[model samples]
Target: MAKEKIVLAYSGGLDTSVILKWLKETYDAEIIAFTADIGQKDELDGLEAKALSTGASKVYIDDLREEFARDFIYPMFQSGALYEGQYLLGTSIARPLIAKRMVEIARAEGATAIAHGATGKGNDQVRFELTAAALAPELGVIAPWRMDEFREQFPGRAEMIAYAEKHNIPVQASAAKPYSTDRNLLHISFESGMLEDPWFDPSATSNEEMYVLSVSPEEAPDQAEYVELEFEQGNCVGVNGEAMIPLEIMEKLNELGGKHGVGRVDMVENRFVGMKSRGVYETPGGTILFAAHRKMESLTMDREVMNLRDSLNARYSSLVYNGFWFAPERLALQALVTESQKNVSGTVRVKLYKGNVIGAGVKSHVSLYNPDIATMEADPTKAYNQNDATGFIRLNALRLKVASGVEQNAKK
Candidate 1:
């Protein structure tokens, strides 16, 4: 009889390394480790070798930076998807893509099961499983953190660390670093440990130690810097007069935004699992892009159309935040957002100063703003007729006058 094969979404981190070994032993299965590269930087170093030596039949490291930025980040940004009106959906948006690729690998490798290191309490377990259920319902999901047996064997980080040492599993996690971090092209998010306290002040040290994408606002340069962003159909195409692809654009913006201390958000958000979780995110490029995109849309979008899109923004944001990236409603909302962005093409200039993204100017050849009609000094174009106000106001006030008459009659 052949050994059962299981595909593991491996990060080459402490938790995953232990899970890789544990899964293999528990199920008596051949473990195939898969790591998705979405701008995790040095985290991918020696991952294949580590997985192989740590006891894995096969190791697959995929570079999905282009697909991630272009497919996932751009569409979410186009929808103005922001969780709880604050979080940029950094970690939330990355889950579906990871799960999608995991499913693809599972099918290609002829694996019977897929496993992840996401905990039982967090949103990622839902994101991963929901995606798997939607895409590959036949594949079994083995979540060790959710299993009581696994939890009993390894209840805390110290137990996992000891087990790793005893089993000769090399891991990056340690007791010294209290919090855990998740990183991708869009942003780096930190949670757990001291960050769990809502009232905890990361500003004490400006959180320079934990933050990877940007410097602290206090540590930013004294002088403000101006940046110009070019957009086409609501997608940022270039920065500072240079044309670049999505991946390149994100890299450059990360550099620029990080230098200026532009994007750092710390908030206590309501999780889909009905618990409040505190998160600190560093999203330099995304912050700059969102501000520039809003400015571009303001110049080119119709008022009513923009209002409708604005109303859908929260709903669209919730869909993504709740791991509904593959849901039908999210697709419908995406279609509407894409339609709304057709004319949102322009250049927006912004000044970045000590965490502030202040808009300087915006322009588009297809802009709906009419200087002549809106000028307060005088309408030399004769576009405005002062006589028009009389009938317009009286007609608008007719209902108000009728309501007043009724109230007066009742009072009498």
Candidate 2:
């Protein structure tokens, strides 16, 4: 009988590389390695050769940058989803896209199972498995870190390194660099290892190496830089008046934002698995977009509509963080978000300097901001009457006056 086949989400990293070899030896399974190119920059270099040398039967690398930004990143950004008001949900958002591709590959290759290198303790495992279950429940999901047998065989990074050495797997991972990192077009995140200590200050010289997509705020140029962003129906369409594709827009913003030391966040965030993790992230492009998008909305969106959307921002963000991208609630919420963006078309100028994204100016053809009524200087012909404030304030103060009288009676 032919050996059972399994599709492994391979990143050519230390953990995944070791998993590839271990799966082959332990299960006697044919390993089909799949790597999704979601803008990992130089990380993809020599990935195919390394996977095949490490014991993969057939390796596949697909470029999903455009798809990732257009479908996953853009929609999440449109909803203004931020996990705990800090993280942009970078790694969290990428997992579903990766899982979706892994499922497709498994079906195509006639594989019976799909495997990932996410540890049992982290949120990625949940994200990957939930996506798999939602998309292809019939396929077996294999998580080595969660299994007792796999954990006993390789207790930690040291044991995994030893196994890799024995199996002749070529990997650059070492015990010296304890922290692990995940990177993509959206952001780069660092956690575990040295970052575990919540009191540890990463601003020290030792932690300088953790940053990849941005520079230190002190190192940024003294002068501020300004950039204009164009949006159509809540999607960024151009930068500095230059029209570009989704991928190109991200690349441009990342370069500009990185140079100005924008988008650096450090916080202890609550993971879906009932634990809090300290993580440092660099999300240059995302930060720029977030600020610019809000500025555009201020100009174009109505006050109450924006407030209603803001009320649901936390719930929307929670759904994304908890790996509910395919869930029904998220889809329904997205519909409302999309509807709210129908008139959110305009250009916003943002000033970037020393880790700050400040709004400079914003304008829209359908802007609701009326200078005639809002200006401090009284306008004789303006529709807004200053006399109307008397009745409005009196009516609003009625409830407070009644409550004060009731309190006095109780004291008496």
Candidate 3:
């Protein structure tokens, strides 16, 4: 009988390199490695060659930066999806896209199962598996980390390193390295290892070098720089008056935001698996865009509509963080959120100074903020009459008055 064919979401990282070799040796199966280039920069350089020499049948490397930025990042931003009011959902958002592409590769390669290097404890496993369950339920998921046989053979990094050396698989991880990083167009996240210590500051001393996307705040230029962000229907379309595609926009924002040391977050976040994990992230471009987008909405969005969306944004963010990018409820939220952005088109000026994105100004053709009716000085335009406020206040205060009277009667 022919050996079973499996497609592995390979990153050419320490864990994946060992998993690739083990899959071939243990299962006696043909393994195809797929690496998605979603803005890891130098990390993608030798992935294809490395996978082949380690015993994979073939390797697939594709540039998904544009798709990632346009489809995943932009739509999520429309709802202003920020997990727990802080996280930009960078790693959380990228997993489903990677898994979706992996499923596609598996189908095209005529593979029986899909596999990933995500450990059982981490959220990535659920992300990868849930995407598979949602997209291709027929394709079996093989998680070697959860398998007792594989775990016993390679209990930790030392055993994996020994196995890689024994099998001649190339990996750059050392036993002493203290953290793992995941990078994409939107952001780069560092977690595990020494980062497990919630009290540890990754920005201190040599750890500062761990930041790849942005500089430390202390090192940023003293002079604040201003940039204008232009949006069309809630999606950031350009920067500094230049129209750009999704990739160009992100690249430009990343460059500017990094130079200003904007968007470094260190926090212990609650993971879906019922534990808190400390992570340090650099999301320069995403932070800039998110700030500018909200400023633009302030000019064009309706008050009640904005409030209602804000109430649901937390739920929307949770859905994205929990790997429900393809779920029905998230889709429904996206639809409602996108509708709210119909008039959210404008330019927002932001000052980037020492890791802060300060709102400078905002203007829109359809802005609800009318100076004629809002100015306290005079009624030159007669747009709003002050006399109308008497009835408005009385009507609104009627319930309060009645409640006060009822309280007094009860006391008596």
Tens digits of lDDT, candidate 2, 1-412: 9889999999998899999998998899999999999999899999999999988999999999999999999999888888898999999999999999999999999999999999988999988888898899999999999999999988877888888888888778876778899999999999888789898888676778768999889999999999999999999999999999889999999999999889999999999999998999999999999989988988898888899999999999988888888888999999999999999999999999999999999999989888877888987557888899999999999999999999999999
Please, what is the TM-score per model?
0.96, 0.97, 0.97
Cα lDDT listed for each candidate: 0.92, 0.92, 0.92
lDDT of 1: 0.92
Model 2 spans > 4 angstroms off = none
Q: Given candidate 2, what's the lDDT at residue 131?
A: 88
| Residue 125 displacement in candidate 1 (angstroms) | 0.8
RMSD of each: 1.6, 1.3, 1.3
lDDT of 3 by residue, 217-321 (tens): 899999999999999999989899999999999999999999999999988888898988888899999999999999999999999999999999889998988
Which is superior by TM-score, 1 or 2?
A: 2
Clashes of 2: 0
lDDT of prediction 3: 0.92
Model 2 root-mean-square deviation: 1.3
